[model samples]
Target: MERSHVPVLPAEIVEFLKPDTTNAGPVVDCTLGEGGHSALLLEHAPDSRLIGVDADATMIERARYFLGPRASQVEFVCAWYDDFWLSYTGARPHRVLFDLGISTFHLAGSGRGFTFREDEPLDMRLSDSVMSAAELLSGISQEDLADIIYVFGEERYSRRIAAAIVRARSSGSLRTTGDLVETVASAVPAAYRRGRISPATRTFQALRIAVNAELERLRMALPRALAALSPDRGRMAVITFHSLEDRLVKWAFRAAAGDEAAVGRSAVTAKHSTASKFAPKLIDTVAMPEGERITVLTRRPVVPSHEEVAGNPASRSAKLRVVEKTRIEESW
Candidate 1:
């Protein structure tokens, strides 16, 4: 059975967007996923024509089916959000949305090894991703693999896990999801294996993120989304599930809003370059001074209510942040 997805902070997202007023203009859902968020957003935005973009073709088809009649209002594009937004030539959108979480569809239905409970192939690439987890594991050194798990996953037993992976791969026994999971389980302590979270969770996450270059695309997408916002007080809402993503959104919003503290701090790291193997490009690019033409709507990131989190465990780590465009430079 295909597990249904629930949009996190659905009510809050609609309220922040004020879709009724903005519905006369174009709206964009940069990460359409299974179209759960877009469906809700469009419910309140009757007149809004939508540009829904997603990297996975399967997701585009699933969203198309799930949307049903609402599909008429949306222009579904099977492309990465960054690519779609950067080259977008249509009318600027008044309301934009980005949900940074991976889709429940991928975890529950896609047989590409997104879930550890399955014994599928370790091919964790979305449509636009360059490499597969299997390919990455087969060639990566133990040291590099450890750094990826540590930096991207924040896994404390990353070194041990990487060592185990290296050993299994060398013996040609690390090709399947089960093999990787077993390797990770053997590396972590008994206590860690019995913790609230699965021991292999971080390893899988890190591998998926690295394979997809998720952070790199997000860094490029934010500025483009800001620029594509209509000059007439366009608003954008982004929902992030991890600290790495939230930090990027926060930094972009702060820099775009001209927050004094952000400006001062950004000066030193504005030109920071990635070192190719920097754990899936750990640092996000700071929005430059000229991009300072927006107002941060959410003073702080919004978390899911206890009730919501209880009902939908996936919402537990979600955080929402919104911003409105003050103006757009002609250069944009």
Candidate 2:
């Protein structure tokens, strides 16, 4: 089936980021992709302007074209999300979105190795400035490779796959998407190879994550995003495509919402400190320091509906989490 230019959970996003009709301000779309979400935001919130950011220059142009006449309402920035957010000097945004998934155009047209279905160069970089996946694989140690695959991809056979990759690269054979796919297929059991998904899916995902330093970028961007919100009622939404990204969003949001458990080990130290004899004075001195800045709108991540998935299977794994800034004074 031909896919529509539908951003996952479009309705949910528009609703979650519903601007005050009287004074809707700018929205920052940190992962502009094809600009589907930004276009929709412009359509839904007439008063809202969009600051669209993307790492890929090609994708930024594509988004500009996709947005067309509505492009007037957007300011496109070809840069990584963290760089754009950290350096932004404009007015605070009332809405922000980070859809952390590769666009359809990226998979189907990028000629980059985002998909194992096609034979492309092993250059799964989001931008030309970053190292290519092939270069990364060739230089990475098997231990580091396995750690990346297991941690980012959550694939159990990471060790075997990493070993196979090292073997293939040592023989100067692992240079393209096809080579990596073949390596992974041979590394896993035949029964596993016959599964519904491609055997190399996890490996590709891991390489892309590592090449882009995607997780680290997200960790740095989230707090900046929270701080960029218009005080009192700004809303931010992040749509993650996999478990690892989702976990980062979940924990970050929980921490912003001031959940003690979300602080994990740090919470214990604070707890013990508060129990000491001088605790009252300490707490009183910094009474407002630890107040929550955000209220998580969705207790559980909002996933694509079955009907939406039926229409666009690429969105099947998309999970959207949203939060609203509580006040201007509650900066992270």
Candidate 3:
């Protein structure tokens, strides 16, 4: 079957990010899945350059093919976003975009065990990451595995599933995607399996996250990304597809914005209360002010429009939050 690729919230993302004004700067597409959003951004902002990053090498290649001549203007990096930050030593970008979680193509086509429907190898490494789902399940203790599934996937029957997996592995190694699926199916009651969603979904999601270290990587990468932003000019946008990711982004943005606000207040109070010759500068001249270093542009995350959702059902779960690095002086 031919796989279809669709960009989520194209019009809204373009509108939220007025890339047209950034004539000479670069925009980082942090999760450049299929390059659909990158293509639109490039089309809208003809003069702006692009730095596209993706953990999946196949998606990067697809972007290159679809983007064609515009591909020359884009710099594609096949690495996890966290590692990308570690290796990058360049000018701060004007805009950054992070579309978190699996893309439609990855869920539907990639034989990485992202979805339970396909019985492929039980591998779920987005990058050439050290761990695979099968390895993780086999190595971890049953209790620890249950904890991972419960916390990451919010699976209610985590203990049952974990016990089943352990039993299955003891008899014969759980090596394939089908083996894992069947294990999960057997753990849940037959009645529940006939419900709206498959019982295996959460277990699969949990395994995928653990295999790729998704949450851990996001936690480490966010601060580094904030630090890399150019004062006043840099803007970062993140789209999260799951609650765990959404919560992380929400808390990160709130913390940054709160810090910025506090710093600004401190500077104002210092300027009015003290008049000594040795009085420190109201704004930190050495660093971008916290206020300038980051601002939460979206009070609430932007969701796909009704039309967009209708056209692409996979995007129904997406939530976009944006942060801008302003011109004031304080640490991020």
Candidate 4:
């Protein structure tokens, strides 16, 4: 399978990123799943340097091959975006792109069990993490497992599915993607199995999220990336395929902006409080100045165009949200 994973929302990303056109600094492709977005940015901004990061070693290798000569312009790292953000203390980057969720290649053919259609091992770790889907199923309590499916995957049949998984595991290890699919199928009503969507889809999604710690990692990474962004000189773009990931990105951006407001008020108070010796104490601060923060570019997230969705079914669910860091004085 030629890794049918086409980059989602390429034109929208390029338009918002505006790479190097304004003499912006370096750009970071935080997800860099096959370097599709990176290659486009490099083509648009010949002078800009690229930092590409992915947790999967296989993705980095594939990116190198696919990007070829353009790959030379990028500094590739095989690490999660969270760790990359912490380790990267260099000059603030001009832009960052985060495409969350599994790439088409992984879902279609990686044999990592991203899809229930494949009979691969139940291993959904994006990185070489300690936990695999099988291990998670084997270890977690049924209640916790059901909660994960309910909260993360939003599956209606979470209780039944989780119970089925526990029952199956008790007999023999539920060790493969086939095992999980069958377990979920058995739990749902026969009518559900023949519904418009697969009965097992949400269960697989929940397990993948659990195995990869995707949401938690994104929550941790977004702040650090914002902190490293140049005031008014940087932008971050995130493409989320589902509601769970989109919710995290939306709230994180709002929270960061809110913190920025609080910090400014504190700054003014500190100056006046000096005489009283109160010191306008900073309780806890992860606040970046308003100028050095994120400004949501899309009041409403940008979705794939009708034509694009028609052409690539995988892109149908994609929603792109962009935030640009503005100078503290600039009203976002």
Q: By lDDT, is 3 or 4 better?
A: 4
The clash count for each model shown is 0, 0, 5, 3
Candidate 1 lDDT, 136-230, residue by residue in tens: 88788888898788766878888899999998888888889999999999999999999998899999998988888887788778878887787
Q: What does candidate 3's lDDT look like per residue over 111-214, in tens digits?
A: 88788888888888887756887778778898878877776777889899999999999999587888888899899999878878889989888888778878
Best-matching candidate per TM-score:
1
Between the candidate structures 1 and 2, which one is better when assessed by lDDT? 1
Candidate 3 residue runs with Cα over 4 Å from true position:
1-3, 20-23, 259-291, 329-332
lDDT of 2 by residue, 147-225 (tens): 7787667677989999999999999998889989999999999988999999889888878888898877887788778
- Model 1 spans > 4 angstroms off: 1-3, 20-24, 263-276, 279-292, 328-332
RMSD, every candidate, angstroms: 4.0, 7.3, 9.6, 8.5
- Find the number of clashing residue pairs for candidate 3: 5
User: For each candidate, what TM-score against the reference?
Assistant: 0.90, 0.88, 0.86, 0.88
Alpha-carbon local distance difference test for all models: 0.81, 0.79, 0.77, 0.79
Error of 3 at 215 (Å): 0.7
Query: Could you tell me the TM-score of candidate 1?
Result: 0.90
**Candidate 2 wrong stretches, greater than 4 Å:** 1-5, 264-292, 328-332
Window of ten residues with lowest summed lDDT in model 1: 264-273
